[model samples]
Target: MSILAEEQIERFFNVLNQSSEIIQKSKDQSYLDSLIEVLDTVQSGDVQALNLAKADTTAVSDIYATFNRDDYDSEVLRKAIQMAVLKAIKVDKIQANYQITPDTIANVVGYLIAGIFNGHRQLSLLDPAMGTGNLLTAVANQLSNSIGVKLSVSGIENDDAMFELAASSFELQHIHAELFHEDTIQNVLAPMVDVALSDLPVGYYPIDANTKGYNTRSTTGHSYVHHLMIEFAMNHVNKGGFGFFLVPSQIFKTSEAKQLLKWMQGHVYLQGLLNLPTELFSNKASQKAIMILQNTGGGAKQAKQIMLGEFPSFKDQTAFQKFLTEIDDWQRNDLLQ
Candidate 1:
């Protein structure tokens, strides 16, 4: 980030914190909830927060006034919101799945998606598990700025706090997205999108009845939610549309791999699986890889040589650039062909 961007983010973030704290204390709500109210106040330029809390209207207005949305670009505003959400997560002690997708991973996803769909004048995207709209907005901003593609974005979040946070963040960034607050597995009414992306939440899905028609549903136990989510996400993708998922590195080595493999056959072409840098995780088991898939139709076929490899540490600038160059070559020579 440039010095100006950094200054903008810090300034905006301080205003968010101050306003959220006032709301939290007055309303007896969690920081996350109060933060959402503050965000809504900033976006609407109305102190609807005054209705929810006993905060002094003048004090709240003064803090909200300091955030002039025009001063920061979408990316800078997003990072500032991300910092506030991270702090809220810490204060609220939310579950692991609520964690924001790191910027490094979001940027990589954006790079891959932009490369794959570069020539399109427009695109539609879906995130089956948008935690707080961070990843979706990051990719949207990249596509718009890099290639000037008009985008239609949609996301689903089951948790109330997350759903509201995403809604607020999307509005604040002026990212027009269709958002649903329903369980993705049970709700399959999503629009058929051109590309589907997710940092798949890890765990076993508890509702077996809803898993009745899913190919990844377990035979003897609750199915892995991540497995079911991938299947669910792909089902909403247009023919030959692509999916980019951040999944556990050992995704295919587990007991549920057979069911997942069965689903992959004839349904989608497994195009690539690139292990993220291991240093990004705290342990081997927590490491993840980006899995690329293309629905099997509209001229989509397996790549001549699947793009597979481990990314060098991002700190190794030369090696990282070489890896990206190789990806560009593969896109031209294999996938696009």
Candidate 2:
């Protein structure tokens, strides 16, 4: 069924029951105004523009209320969206797959979400993290209406969540999800956390001071693992390719994060940094950084970072658009140009 069909209606209702924004859109006229902008963009004779209007604004509002529930925070919802899309695929068609994975989804969304903000094109292929893909499913749901080709996908998620979810999602829809059950974290502890420990490991918010590092520390399991995400993105991406990776925010200022960021800044073109607010994982949101890196050029002289404020009404996408419009042009011109 189409994402905009009965399933979507049921999903929206599901959100209405759980999300804070269920009844807030009416009260938030600016958000409604953003919807008007989206409608205007869609009616401007560009199908992709319309898709962008929906994807960036309207669809997001719905997703925020539904898929982005507290239980489905960033990482989990990232997984759930992947799982939902996997369930959306056809079983037999799994044989003819795009090989998308959780990592791939993380990478691609990281890139696209940020890239779309900068108004970029020409990013055609993606190499998903190579294992059964919960992340890829999220990407599929995220890009359901976009007219772009999934050239190739490589993914890895060492647990059954990867395989079981990927397989089921594939059977539900026609989308191809190339999945694997390999441990994508290299140079790190194998299966670092307990399978049951899927929630946001407390104290992940980006604070100037140390909050409370639950499962985090400067260990192999801590920082080196993300290096793999960076190395993979820096290496596997086709020249001039852009990749989005769900890397930790510490990589921006922390000494450990520096290794990867330094390599990224020196080797690949450094785009903007989206400093997502805290507790995104508080319920359905997780405070995570979406690293939009590119292999198009050899890093930036200085990375441009943007701090995003709070948007309690995730359904009110107009606030986000307002935020985007509010983003200083001088700050964005570095990469957006």
Candidate 3:
């Protein structure tokens, strides 16, 4: 079920838009006040709110039930939509867990939009481990506001509860999905997706019986519950398609993600890396990384290495400029060709 009734929300949008064209702040606040009234009605868990609002139950059925009415606000709604859109982008690594804090969602969403808007082809999105759909929502809002977010998205998640929540979130927003209740890596067809993988086995044995051992690690067997979340970003993303994803932060900093990085390098140009804030994760291991990749059709030298750096720790759209400056500085240095 949608958190806010769609008709009610649409009216708010209509009013909000009308107010935007005028200079009167009170005019906008009038519409905003109406929106707040609706938010108040829809925020409560009481069936009365659902019934009275007469919301589309189909869309409202997911996380709305879990929403603490007291928490209902513009920030809450913005966060929910932000998370939903970003988790649906197409990439080869990581899945956004809805368990992620609202602050993290806000920060990532801002950075994602900032870092990925330089190209002209638009973007294709994916989120393999969509929880309550924070990432996808964020991506959608950013793209709609950005100059180049014209791509579709896909996703997959094995957790039934999470899958249901994600599906509901997407439907409410009039967004389509190809989400599946399956392992992310096992299935490859997607606008985008990720599979959780576990148990890496490394061997020093010779290749077959003909070559010397090359010290390789392989995930030939993926446990049903433990598979690498390989984000396959393919929303018709052309050769230079770009992706910004929040996977297990260790995928870039630890031995676990090291090989995956090497594997990833063979497929896409690794752009910048942003060390994520430790406070954002639910897990004790707060260290994480944001990866940027671009697929270059094989006509020139594959990128050997891309820039890696820190992003600002802010939630406003204004922070985007800080990132652009960093990227600009990197490019002016001829760091990326």
Best by lDDT: 1
Model 2 spans > 4 angstroms off: 1-132, 148-151, 185-223, 283-286, 296-316, 325-333
Residue 123 lDDT in candidate 2? 26
Give the distance in Å from residue 295's predicted Cα in candidate 2 to where it truly belongs: 1.4
User: For candidate 3, lDDT tens digit of each residue in 1-337?
Assistant: 2646554444433332332222123233332232222333333433344332233333343324544434333334554443333332221123443243354454455544544454635454566555555556556555555555464666666666456655655554556656667654444455422211111112222223221121123433222121133323422245655555554455545444555555465565666566655545466465556655566553423345566655555444467467767666664453345
Compute the lDDT for candidate 2: 0.40
- How many residue pairs clash (N, CA or C atoms closer than 3 angstroms) in each of the candidate models, in the order given? 0, 44, 49
Overall local distance difference test of candidate 3: 0.45
Q: Write the per-residue lDDT of candidate 1 for residues 1-337, one digit (tens) a residue.
A: 7898899989989989988888888879899888988887786669863574343677788887777777778888899999999999899998888899999889899999999999899899999999898999999998899889999999999988889889988888889999999999996588999999999999899999999999899999899999999999999999999999999999999998999999999999999999999999999999999999999899898999999999999889999999999999999999999
For candidate 1, what is the lDDT?
Answer: 0.91
Answer with 1 or 3, whichever has the higher lDDT: 1
**Cα RMSD for candidates in order:** 1.3, 16.6, 12.7
Deviation (Å) of 207 in candidate 2: 29
In model 3, the Cα lDDT at residue 32 comes to: 23
TM-score for predicted model 2 compared with the true structure: 0.49
Q: Model 2, 109-169: lDDT tens per residue? A: 5334443433433223333343344455455444443534332333445445335544543
lDDT of 2 at 103: 50
